[model samples]
Target chain A: MAGTDTSKEFMFRPTPAIVLCEPQLGENIGTTARAMANFGLWDLRLVNPRDGWPNEKAVAAAAKALPVIERVRVFDTLAEAIDDLNLVYATTARNREMFKPVIGPDEAADRMSAHIGAGQKAGILFGREKWGLNNDEVALSDAIVTLPVEPAFASLNIAQAVLVLAYEWRRAALKDAPLPFAGDEGEPAPRGQIVGLTEQLGEALDRAGFFKTDAKRPTVMNNIRAMFARAGFNAQEVRTLRGVVAALDRRHERPNPARLRKNDDEQ
Target chain B: MAGTDTSKEFMFRPTPAIVLCEPQLGENIGTTARAMANFGLWDLRLVNPRDGWPNEKAVAAAAKALPVIERVRVFDTLAEAIDDLNLVYATTARNREMFKPVIGPDEAADRMSAHIGAGQKAGILFGREKWGLNNDEVALSDAIVTLPVEPAFASLNIAQAVLVLAYEWRRAALKDAPLPFAGDEGEPAPRGQIVGLTEQLGEALDRAGFFKTDAKRPTVMNNIRAMFARAGFNAQEVRTLRGVVAALDRRHERPNPARLRKNDDEQ
Candidate 1:
């Protein structure tokens, strides 16, 4: 309402719709609502709450997020809940083996931001507690949003999963164009330049006959490259390395003590 | 006494002394204990709890972390609580502009790890619920740890503060050494090599006319160095970069471009 052309600007896009498919616990719902409030998400659609609506536990859990719970919309089915939204993302832990792009929370947030920028209403569907969304429910969404988790411990609490995704989405939406560094105001060194620096250092090492064994060559080179890459060596760093390499080469090229002594004695 | 030496090796050595200075609420204490357990902090020192020792609420709130609460040692004064510890860090929300090194939870954790590695006991001091650690109590710490939050809304619950610090300490202590690049033989890159690489990369960029402008030079160069440092480029990456720089230089140095073009046209 603040921005008349809400659909045009990325930030002013319609708030994402959150659909809970038969959420069992009121506390979980309340926490989920609180998590949503943390990131400015308001729209909440409930499809068949187990203990009925307007639960006291949920109200208590909502704490400062009471406004979010007050505006909840109830639906009889998952399809009905997502009918108004143009795009829906299903939150799940399973792989599903679906061809639809399955992305982690960060990537999903990026895609969501792009869609929201286009002025389309998007929704994220969360499953019930005890058991998550069934195959039929998952099939309704455009994409699957999975939290990057260890394979052995994939299951995440309903509210926690929602919280993580919501946080990521808000971050992606609110962030300005990323600068080269965390706090600096400059473009990153061109990718080509960085690649070139890495190559030069490698050649210098090779010229110095550092890679004595063929088997150990790749490993040694990779370690060196990783070290430099991690350091974010700019153009200046490359020059410094060349100097060191040159110094080493010059030292190696100098006549040995035995050869010098033998020549001096002959003279 | 279960495997004293073995447990000692895996035992938590808290650098930030959790000082419950005149805490009134038993439930808060329990919650704080639970939070500490969540982050692998067991050393808790109470400075005059109001509702008597061994409160049921404290135990109930501690839940699975009752062991941490049980092990909490009570003292009459804050100084006595941290006297045995080698270094002490205090957690406070209020800005105390004292010249003493103030750090965030992450840095505090790093420092704690170093102290613990050197076999020195470390502790963090936390204040009461109603009014946190007083000026005098805070001054007793070797360093102050502050959580970066909005100035207008800076307060954090006692348990939450403990949780954050605990999380950072555990992360620093438990972080696994990164796998060695192909030829590194699982050994960490020596500090000297890393420093050399950093210097070399800086020099190379300067030679390639990368940092021509002085105004934005420091920012650009520092950022580039940081990026490479974070990437941890290995030997192979360094070589790759060198080749790229060589090619660029060759292209730039090619003389008689017009003559070459004429020859091409004749051909």
Candidate 2:
């Protein structure tokens, strides 16, 4: 078992237990554990794993997800694996004849979030790596969960399937939690910085004969200002642009290459 | 080249390209191709691949994505590989020092759809296996795309990253066939135009000494490129910028504002 970090405690939340039925390879189980850990899923139940439990190959493949591998529980039958869960979703690639409610991972996650939020245990049942779970095994599940993969290549490997499901489950569970990083433009720069940039660039363009005529200066300047406004530069970016104007402006004056480089470095 | 089915033509549409930079293992490349094919993505570009092209291991591991593996394009440099792409998103696991907009997979997919729908090329860049994209590599991208994984297990291998992005892209493109709103930014400037602008400005900056040293030139140019990419300029904006560059470059061609006034007065 790998050391667990209590500080990173999202695993303690009500996440759906991952149940693999008749999983063949220890590598799949280990990778499945890795996928689960990546999305903060913890509970792992195996119904008749071919290689049995506590497999070293599974541990080696699980990487730093030892907390998930260490806590895996093996069961003799599909019924036993999901016995304690109040709700279960059976994931399958191919369309089945059974009249179960088929739902996508997002909806499944939402339902599971609601079910687990109400203090009822829930689990997702996945099938074998080769041919998936038998009809009887799937019948034990409460509903069907399928990914929206292309019809031509619908099948997803065990770990890949687990990854998508776990990702959605965590997303649903943390509905209000903000993304790890905000898409900030650094407060959109201060209005004064924008004005300063516009004035400096407007003056440079004026001297460079970009306006063509003094009468056309206002309209052209307005267009240039509008374009800069449309770009929505941050403070840092405004500073960079000012440096560009200054560098270009210096071309009309003395050609001091060394001093120009020094000025840019200081900026 | 692997035989492809014309019937599976979702790959033909304005789909985002999948680019892997310095991918170490052929197995990962093959599985990434599989993941792309599963979600109907066909374009696969490799940059400076470690094992060379047409690898047997990649073909063996690619499962049913023979078409993708067959049509793989390899480039010696990242810039060359992404030269034709109008918009590029670089995937990174860790926080970066730059100010490119950071978005999740879903948002990235939506943005890609909007860009591609407007008749512009878009691509997602995946980095190496051991460490992700370097700062300079990321700087060439229009934006930074990150996943919503547990921070403790934030990193995803090449194949997994492709799977998530490809899955979201398919869902955004197909499932939501009718976009909520039309793209307001007319068609964005093509890659050639953007590259031309960058090159022309870079030369002007070089002569003007915006870069402090030859060693610092790449970093400064990358920052400049990233800033323009982040602006998401349209064709007209690019033209306006080219004119600005030409006007700036004319500073060495004698004082012309007085001559321009005389010509305007004569008109």
User: Which model scores highest in TM-score?
Assistant: 2
Error of 1 at A54 (Å): 3.7
> TM-score (chain B) for model 2?
0.62
- lDDT tens readout by residue for model 2, B1-267: 012223454345568889999989999999999889877788999999999998888888888676588789999999999999999999876667677788888889888988888999999999888887888999999888877777555556789878888988887887644221122344678888999999999998887878888999899888988999987777888999999998888786666888789999999
Q: What DockQ does predicted model 2 obtain?
A: 0.08
lDDT of 2 at B25: 93
- After superposing candidate 2, which stretches have Cα over 4 Å from the reference? A1-10, A182-184, A256-267, B1-11, B176-267
lDDT of each: 0.67, 0.82
Q: Compute DockQ for each candidate against the true complex.
A: 0.01, 0.08
Q: Which stretches of candidate 1 lie above 4 Å from their native place? A: A1-25, A31-48, A66-267, B1-17, B96-102, B142-144, B148-156, B177-267
